[model samples]
Target: MKRRFFCSTLFFITPLLILACNGPSDPGSNFSSGSVTPPLFAHSVKSLLTLSVIEPADPKRATALGQYLVWLVQIDRNGEPFPVNAISIDGGMPAHGHGLPTQPRVTAQVSEGRYRVEGLKFTMPGRWILNFTVSSKLGNDRFSLEIDVGH
Candidate 1:
């Protein structure tokens, strides 16, 4: 009975002894963090489109031409193109002007080499948030890019 108890205690204490002997300190202690940080603008456009622009006036009438311009987005990890999901441009001028479209969503597939976004119009010159949704084999992610066009 004593022999069996000793063997059981030895088995449980062996792993603990080994773990205590191999504490956390390592050779490369200078490294700040384990995970690598991706570039701000390189990996995504969450820092580009933030500024706002006023609507242009129409020739026939003084009515504002409330329309957002289209944008083409491209992502290159190492100078090579890759596929992305969809992009959304919200908040534009002329409160009563044509509202932004809902369906036939802006997709990357429409444009072969680049991701295309329609209805990127600005309502008034101020601050705006441009959100971009990128889908990859790994997963789908959202990024907010700020862009200033006019003053």
Candidate 2:
């Protein structure tokens, strides 16, 4: 009976010890608690769609180097969740004239206007612009989110 109890205790404590030693699986999860700059407002005159980051609030400073999920929602001029037929996300450094290290793709439409983008990895620290093209029955609109990394 004692041997069985000891084995169970050891098994549970071993995993805890390993986790504590390694720390957070993704260190980038500790970035400053705030939304991206410019407040994620819409700029298009005709479409008037806005994109706001809902996860990793401060994308300017990532918590890890691997792929990360980017969550965003779109709103219309009336401040209501606006549904779009499709959305494409891409980014790059304007100065360097290059694109993002990873090709982020829209994985899902969480709701009417919310979206989840996966496979976004910033290999290096520099200025990055995330361009999003929103399309719907009405028309297609484009907007950009500017992120400054390693500053």
Candidate 3:
């Protein structure tokens, strides 16, 4: 009788001890690296303006660590290409609580409504939000492009 009671207690307590040591499992706690789903690189800052990313492509290709990348900016109004007075670009990962690793500048206007972005670099694979401030005679509007940099 004593031996049977001890075996049953050991079986129950053994499983409980194993579970306690491992802790609870969270389904959403998985850390995904690289291969992030691409986001639509377009947004309407306001009725007067729309912004889009034209370079590096959506679902940005696998960029090696510490490599320089170029971003292209395009603007439109009423379905037609329109140029803004000045465009400023900046980016960061809100989830990571950090900003970009480099300061990207709109070096030149490529055409009527397109601009060339230079000095862009991604240090890691994650989601980054690119902020574009479009200033023109009408006013100023801000837009964002969510980019996924792969490893």
Candidate 4:
């Protein structure tokens, strides 16, 4: 009886562990550029301005366990440049329940509605969520984006 119980428990537990490791957000596989279901590459929370990455075209390909720069363009609902006075960055792996490995920030404004993000590094291959807050004439708005990384 003890052996049968152990066998049944193991049989159920093994498949569950396998399924958990092979989930959509599995760190081993390379998923990027809004490829995840329901399109998580955009924002978890909406903002007055829409932020989109303009550089490193593919985040999964850019992942190398080092720092990198990511450029972003913020446009309004009408496709006009959002007047941004200040911007901040914060994000992390929600599954892991921690913040970004580094403190990334908006270093400069490349042009109207275009900003340069610096000091972004993904130490491990997994799903990461990035949050950006913009202070504009309208008000302070915060948004989020999910990116896949692999090294």
Worst 10 residues of 4 by lDDT: 36-45
The candidate that wins on TM-score is 3
Mind giving the per-residue lDDT tens digits that candidate 1 earns over 1-151? Answer: 9999999999999999887776666545566666432222333544322211111222112112345455445555445565554444443223335433432246444443355555455544433444556556535556554433332
lDDT value for model 1:
0.45
Give the C-alpha miss distance for residue 128 in model 2, angstroms: 0.7
- Candidate 2 clashes: the total is 2
- What's the count of clashing pairs in each model shown? 15, 2, 0, 0
**What shift in Å separates residue 66 of candidate 3 from its native position after superposition?**
3.2
| Candidate 2 vs candidate 3, TM-score winner | 3
Write model 2 residue lDDT over 39-100, tens digit each, in one string.
Answer: 44445536466666666565443324444646555545467777888878797888899988
- Evaluate model 4: give its TM-score: 0.64
Residues 1-151, model 4: lDDT tens digits: 9999999999999999999878877775684656533322354144445766666555444454555656554545456666678888898988889888888887778888777777888876778878887777777777777776655
TM-score of every model versus the real structure: 0.43, 0.63, 0.67, 0.64
Give the C-alpha lDDT of model 3: 0.75
Candidate RMSDs in Å, in order, are 19.1, 11.6, 6.9, 11.0
Maximum-lDDT candidate: 3
> What are the clashing pairs of model 2?
28-63, 28-64
| Candidate closer to the true structure by TM-score (higher is better), 3 or 4 | 3
> How well does candidate 3 match the true structure in TM-score terms?
0.67
Tens-digit lDDT track of model 3 for 41-127: 566567677776666565444233467867677788877778888877788888888998899889989999988888878787877
